[model samples]
Target chain A: MIEPGSFRDPTSRVFYDAGRVFRGLSHEAAEVDAEVRSSGLMNDLVSRGLFVDNWIVNDVTPPSGVSSVSVIESERVPLVTYPAEWPFSILKDAALATLDANLISLERGFILKDASAFNAVLRGVTPVIIDVTSIERFGERGIWTAYGQFCDHFLAPLMLEAYAGIPIHRTLRSRTDGFPIGDLGRLLRGRSGFRKGVLSHVRIRNFFENRAAGMETSERRDVGKATLARPAIVASIQKMRGLVGSLESCAPSTWADYESALPYEESSIDEKDRFVSEAAVKAGAKGLAVDVGANVGRFTGILAEHFDLVVGMDNDPGAADGLYDTVRRSDFTNVTPLVVDMTNPTEAFGWRGKERAALSDRLHPDFATWLAVVHHLCLGIGIPLDEVVEQIFDFCGESVVEFVAADDPMAQRISATRSTDLAPYGVEEFEEYVARRGVVLNKKPVSDTRTLYHLKGR
Target chain B: MTDPLFAYIDPGAGATLAQLALAGTAGLAAIGKLRMNKIKNRLTGKVSVDSESEPDVPSDESAATE
Candidate 1:
């Protein structure tokens, strides 16, 4: 299917046939295509791992059903993750990658016409530009065309996440285009108003936008030529590299201390890991495996060994960032870490709310493992067990999860201050929910109070 | 209502340039730092600072498997 998110770019459209991903260039993009091909810079960038590798499909005839002047097959990104879902460091890396691409493109007589965050995807931990068609011939436009987009898509969100402690991913759920500059200006403290980057990018931009809003189009046009010379634009790109490179570290969340606050004995943890690995191997999972509530990726590392891609998702931004660091350092090429809350996941947003797919729809895993988090979801958050199971089954073919007995220490502690309505919240009630939608393949009592079950959708 | 010659610079670009103009020497300092890094890399025969080995991104902390 031609992805809904791939429709905004008119120069090219991405399509998936069977299991492979391909891009079809419109006749209008023929010149850009030829320029990219003749230069061989795309291939060079691909070799250096800066650009996602794409090959011109010479042997095939545009896959017969597809129509275009030229067709190229791109290596399928294991998971199509968005910038909103990225950690501070990952977002910084993407910004650097964009500037790096611009610098390299300039060297090769081209420039990236689009700097949207959606154009880049994380393969493992490294950010690679996926949209090859965005590259265009560089000329004397005398302005950095993508400067504003770079700020909205990269700078604004990173600053908020870094300085204000607001999660960029959550903010992006409302508006995928970018965090509005005016909103950012207001959100940051008044003290930050004096900072140069903030002064120029946020405060001044808001000033101009507000002033422009009140002025007639003709009057606004009367403003002096803001076109930047080549050297100035080049300097701007270099300055952006420095700004992106120095983003402050994200503050730690409660889950950041999860490793030290872990309640389980080490032997019990090992047992749980063994149970999870054996269940995955028995189920023959190979597509995507997600560890929902994967605090710091303790179990995601095991899931990565079996699945083509493993997404470690958690609500805590700090935990997700920690997991990203862990996965990036390891030899595992199949794992990605993202900040996502299962209760309130990311929805489809962007142009007409279809430019970027919803988190549940886009990262639909073949199997999902929810470890030591069901109690927190049920007792701590008050979401019904049946609803949680149904939601989990809605996105995956099979699910492996654990249920904590209501009287367990962790469950009790979480629900301690709540009402005494604990009669209906038990392992039996949880199993009944699973049976309604799927078949239970195996169930193991991992501990005195915790039970693990592997189930397949009916 | 876009400028025909500078059609690429949208309102967002205007905002960015607004910020860059006000940033003053901060931008210049950044550019100078970049030039020094480039020269250092050139002298040491090191690959460009954009490589995966950049020290700006902290090294991965060991995963707690236990």
Candidate 2:
């Protein structure tokens, strides 16, 4: 049951068996464990919800070829999301959490050995460090070893998103290992390069890398031996925290105001929520939902109330960003909004293309709720109604979808330019298509032209 | 003596290059000084764990010795 991505650290490996996360530590890491236990830092952080708690499980024998001094187990995370799938605020929170961990480590005479963004996973809105083995005693703080990895994994991608207007997930998915400073510098040539933090962390670092490439091996080796004071390294960490902390998504707020812009009458909104909730109960949705195209997350919020976990995905970063802010401010721990264009879903990336699983693979939901996105997919994106139904079924076996008739004002507005030859488009056509492939649990008309249907895969 | 608690990470050439740019010549010189201290400690039979103390004098060493 060895987890595939847990091999990076030679000191420890994570295993999943019987629905539990077990960590096996090598003999070498025993002393580190002792030190960690003694420092009380781990306990303190865990108490604060910054890290997952692990308990020694002495009775369990580890797998072959592993000589573990200690075997500890924790509750397995149901969905492990990569940094690439996170929205702006989620990534920002993770970066701050990492820096906060480092600050706490500094006080305890230690630091994070690895600053990979993959080490942290969100528990609701809180970022928790899942890898306990990443902590190590800071001996000669002359060099912050994880600095490059941190900047590449967290800072660079963030700056690209905030300044260069590149989506964080897109940049991260392409460069799974980490964003290389050389390419980062090139992308950030003019206005972004002149920014304060960008100049040193990206541009200057690139300059040094280019300069080193020209020098002899001995010269480069000489440079490798260079060191900075411990205080300087700490200062650098502090400065970076400030830089990453200051970054805010400049994505337009047009979609943030989408809720007010909707033409749905108050009664129609109530009817939609009531129908979805009733369908959710009948579906026996114990806890997971994927709300596609969750503009301003109105339906997502309704879904969040019924489900333990709800991912509100929208193509507009502005809409997702607004939802994230709303979720953070409220007590809605189950809801998370991420920018995902349903047309081009996230694919499996990295080593062997298995490092980060595809978005579809990671999402195992009890139900999928497509409120108003079907019309957008069909009329807006020109995908056929049958194809849209197939995509919905592909997401989850049980679904509650709304059918916006071709004559609906919204649908008319969306396909105004296209031919009215929606030859195979109508409520009757949708019912016929689903009847051949699935069972229609219920169908209720919410408006003159809008109808909601609850369907289960055959 | 290598403390099992301490791990070695090859920070790679890119990181070293960044360190040089950030810290200049003074920083470069400190590396040699630190390396010389390592040699000096080896010759003098002194084990320096960190800037804070001698390796032989672990925080709980006196308790163990007694």
Which pairs of residues collide in model 2? none
Off by over 4 Å in 1: A58-67, A194-196, A214-226, B1-13, B16-66
Best by TM-score: 2
For each candidate, the DockQ is 0.07, 0.11
Model 2 B-chain TM: 0.27
Instruction: Report the C-alpha lDDT of model 1 over A97-214, residue by residue, as the tens digit.
Output: 8998888777776777778888899887688899877777665443455777888888898888877778777776656567777888888886655554786677767765664443
Q: Which fraction of the native contacts appears in each prediction? A: 0.17, 0.22
Residue A251: error of model 2 in Å? 2.8
- List where candidate 2 sits over 4 angstroms from the true fold: A214-226, A419-423, B1-9, B20-66
For model 1, what is the error of residue A292's alpha carbon versus the real structure, in angstroms, after optimal superposition?
A: 0.9
Cα RMSD of all models vs. native, in order, equals: 12.9, 8.4
